[model samples]
Target: MKAGRKVWSVLMLTLIIAVIAAGCGGGNGKNTGGNAQPGNSAGTTKTSTKDNKDVVIAVNANFITLDPHNASDTNSISGARTMYEGLLGFDENMGLSPALATEYKISDDGLTYTFTLREGVKFHDGTDFNSEAVAINIARIQDEKNNLRLRKSFAKVAKVETPDAKTVVFTLTEPYNAFLNKVAMAGMISPKALEEKGENIVKEPVGTGAFKFKEWVQGDRLVVVKNEEYWQVGVPKVDSVTFRPVPENGSRIAMLKTSEADFIYPMPTEQVSEVEGVEGIKINKVDSTIVRYVTLNTTKKPYDDLKVRQAINYAINKEAYIKVVKSGLGKKLDSTMSSKTQHYSQQNGYDFDLEKAKSLLAEAGYPNGFEAEIWGENDSETIKGMQFISQQLAQVGIKVEVKSMEGGTLSDMINSAKTPEEAKIQMWYVSWSPSSGDADGATRGLFSSEMWPPAGANTAYYKNENVDKWIAEANKSIDPKVAKDIYANIQKTIWEDAPWAFMGVDQIVSGSRDYLNGVKVYPDGSINIRQAEVK
Candidate 1:
């Protein structure tokens, strides 16, 4: 196991100009319709009946894509995990574990990785899972023409060799300490399916996981059925899983209470108290590596000025945000990466000070703050956070118009931008979890200039030559001390640059029926249901 086991953890516009001009305010600050208290049975665990064999999970948003190699969002990653299996995977503790690959070893020089893949594994489409299958997946991601979202993670991969059916070897151009973690994150796809679907792979994902794709209704729900021939025996106890996108917090709570949903993610911190005493319902909370922040489009005016970015950061009260927006259930974010993330180093904290913010604004040549718009998903909590941001920035003379739209629409708007100049975004209230369980996962996608939109998650258009250099160095460093130092420098420099308004760290709160067993939420907010069972 020592092979690589060293490290462990939008917008929409329109209906007329009037609606756009009039900012959309936050919803009434109260849980209303979903307030029906659970019955006495809520407090006790119920035995799973035959009808309960199929589990229903309600999420805050829809999945963006099922293609594991191209997924960047948490919801999408969770969905892809249901059907895809990587050579390596993270254990419950977020440590590296063998998945499709039974064993692996790294060369002393750290330039070569040899893997022993598990035998008899088969893709959902019945394709044999062997060394060739692993090679095909790696080649797909490493292919420059594909422009896969996770291509950079495999950038150092120089060559791949499959000596036999059950063995695959990867040769790196240079030492990469994070390569194992990246492999774990890059789930394998069926070569046959890739050939058949090609670009449509995102819609038709085929893999060797516990569950096989059943159906996907965009914007509404995604359903997956258990794989009877799953490589791992006696697992995937549930017959099926249906993930419904319920953006409304109250509606999700209601579904949980009524047993319409066996589980729901993001138990909406504001309503945690409401379900605390409910019978037959359990609320699970864990510290997460997720960080909520506002990506300030650095290429845009006002935000283009470093002083303005810093001023915005100083203006907002992060503690108040945790209290009001998160209902005091989260931690104020101090750095670009969450403290739970690997190689995380606390940077100089930005305390709320209106005077300093105003002064900085004045120095940035805007004594009177300018007008701008902030965009976020239509989720209740997201809009509330954006509203709070709008109000806080207003105090610093920055007039903000808040616009919340469906998640898919917002994604289209952001990703469609071909360049920084074409990006219409000014500020985007968003959250990110480096589910890959590495410092590079947390930093590279958001900070590295090479990861700009359409290619990676760097939506802010933030660029820094020094930070980029350090990011690459940190990933390639085999020495922990060197990597840690480089990461610390990266965080410190980004913190000072203020490309983002660090908001808070998430408390991964999920609610499930007491009878739902073995379903655990990881620190990255992705749920593990491979061993989940009812009763």
Candidate 2:
């Protein structure tokens, strides 16, 4: 029964690109197609992704949920986007873009934000798109009882008023530079569906996007059909969009080559060479905001000790992580946030040192490494990453058992723990991108004590009095300089605290058949299919 709880309630919850010479497929992810590799590198004979009526996306993991607010992971957020619309949205570059809202203005005083609604738009369920609909959506996220992961993003909202059918205004208690980005992340749900479906809306979602949910079989495939009533005219170019989860690298690669999948994300950097000379497949690489790390649960045993946490960071070889795990396609993470992120500030230390790691482990009362379990998604790369980490940690006398699961099941395990004492994760090998594209989005949800699982994604259960104060100060600052300084302190403190084993930032690589067009992966590593069509 607990597992049946809506993900909306639970899951609210990079790199250098130095290997560009080795041909990883380039796209700075700044603009849609700029700097990308040619559609067909080989320019050989093959069936074009052209002239097809439907498109299939093969992803490395399963979607966690369809509920926009509760869609915690990028895959879930990507799936939700097919059926959802927000007052504001992020462009391919992660810049703020108007979605349901036609235009907006912020008061010079920095507390009030006013938006004009897009008219003549109807949700997939036929509900009118208006100020009230936006109000209803924000209200759900603001409610603490619902435990929405999006709550923190909207925490500053002091008031929301619909001045007219087309106008909605928000008054925040304090200034938050990231507010607009947060607003963009809140995919607007249909008021009619929310009232009717209630919690069931997680499975039966309704929205105002180019496509509508047709079927979701879970762990297999999810389908969406063109929304005839979609506000954007001449869109939904494909008759249907199917998302298949093929976790195995070999199988996913085979699917794309055999025409079973038109596109596959995480194109398995190790296999990029296999598809490069292929006839119908194209490889796309981009500098991204994604960071990979092993979350060391501070509330759990062997990790509660600060020295233990630091040792884990010291033990992992960040260089090998890029060279071996990422196939020399990424940069070693230099800070809590990717260097590509706004307000990013670098912190020193955490370089690979086996002797130092062993010493730290001994100092932490673990002269003979203690046994622990590490968790990750059941995908070839992730399992490989985990194995790599396990082997590296082994050198420091830390023996770990690796565990992997589907995205949905992983989300459930992390969120089911209502409190830190009930949490089970000792270490989690995971990757994160602040989909909202802000420093607060990167820091708060993962490091703030207030965000501990079920409320937000602070799965490490890390907390600090000074760090918390700095986070609040940073959020409330109106000047960029002041916010920048505060964020610097937050990063410096977190880096020393070592709640995570800083790994590497990704050089995002994805592949699609030469015939596929318009589907793109944003800098935040989110899949965008709004304009997906055959070549």
Candidate 3:
């Protein structure tokens, strides 16, 4: 027993050493890392192709799925983006931009959206992209039989019409202010592939983009080759782009240093100084919408009590968490979404007060720390964050056992629960970005009662009559000011409810070879390789 204990301690200490050696920008809509240097201008990657060299990018997590209609994680969405072009897209700062759709218009009532499909666009499968393709993609998402993640968001669609080869119109059941944003989130998949591949399309993706999916060796690499017959001329500067999933921080950084990987993201925060002045390498730090937090399952005991939830928030030291866990590359999370997100409003956050946390715990009938488990992805930085939470909670009479699982495993564990009562999760240390670039994207899926477990990401099982109503009211509201006001109310109420221990906002820190250009990280943390080049 003693020997086993020593071995376990040694392994943990080694992991801490490797993990604490991290540094960078986190994803955000507002500021980059508080004190981290902005290595270069955010979107200065060269757009023109100079060479047909293959580019390699190393990321910290494996992609979950490539099917855009069902992609739930950022990495998976990014992987899908390599081969898929949405009707609309986001600019660097997350402003809506035209992609497959050349022009779009919204009705005054916000119930109808009409788009002019880009002319001469062809899918990797050689099928023409037109209004019919758009209708097919929307139908796939709207069909409940498909069980797509995008189904709920598109449920408002009452009808999709293809009046001509180039025009697509959508009529919603009611006014939805975010219809345009949701359209941007909908990536265009080949109608041919959809009809033939069916459910297999998740693994075998066919789309109309600058790149075409070559192969995906799960957990190893997802490779996309340049489309020789791409519609947009003089684009896709590289011959091929290979995304390698190197989860270990040390391994990923080493690949960048040894020139094995042309680029790496989440440039280990603690190791940023080590690579800042290195030759032949460039770092890009961008303000993003990524925010980290720990979800406390409100359906469970202790966490069910508002006082207990508030105590956990008070117990965490936000500033120290940024410095220690994030290696000073992040800002304390002030709201559920980063200030960069649209309709963001700040609120008074629970400051670190160990005494107050203890007092609250005592009032909740636990004078001594209660034993609980904290869950996180099995990554160096995530484990460190979980450890930091564990230590902070211990000071306030909360004894937490940290459990780290792979991203897919952790996701399955949380989502496998058929109901709230079946969920075994106590706390989950995770990060989220409003990839859709809307406050509704940030708030609704996470806090709405209609979204729970397999349905959506409301892991807290947080349900409030007013919050639910405000979400609906906000969605139906066409006026930005009215939506802002309703969102503010929702934020304030949830802030008081304390369903999560708001951690910090991340600045996306990434490193690229000087020769590798045009790959940029969006404010939502999804990597854009539409114009990747080996200059």
Writing each residue's lDDT as its tens digit, candidate 1 over 312-357 gives 9988878878876787889899888989889999977678777789
Report the Cα lDDT for residue 486, model 1.
93
Give the winner by TM-score: 1 or 2.
1
Candidate 1 local Cα displacement, residue 516, angstroms? 0.7
- C-alpha root-mean-square deviation, each candidate: 8.4, 9.5, 7.7
Name the runs in model 3 displaced over 4 angstroms. 1-52
Query: Which run of 10 residues does model 3 get worst, by summed lDDT?
Result: 27-36
The sequence of per-residue lDDT tens digits that candidate 2 reaches over residues 1-535 is 4444333222211122233322223222221111122233333437554556788888888888898998779899899988898888888878888889999999998999999999999988887989998889999999989978788789999999999999999999989888988989898888999989999899988999999999998878889999998887889788899888777766666666666778889887877875676777788998999999999999888899999998889887788679767888899999999998889999889887666788888898998889999999977789878877877787678898989997778888988999999999999999999999999989998888888888887888999989989989898888999999999999999999999999999999999988888999998889988898785
Which segments of candidate 1 are over 4 A away from where they belong? 1-50
**TM-scores of the candidates in the order shown:** 0.91, 0.90, 0.91
lDDT scores in order: 0.84, 0.84, 0.84
Q: Estimate candidate 1's alpha-carbon lDDT, on a 0 to 1 scale.
A: 0.84
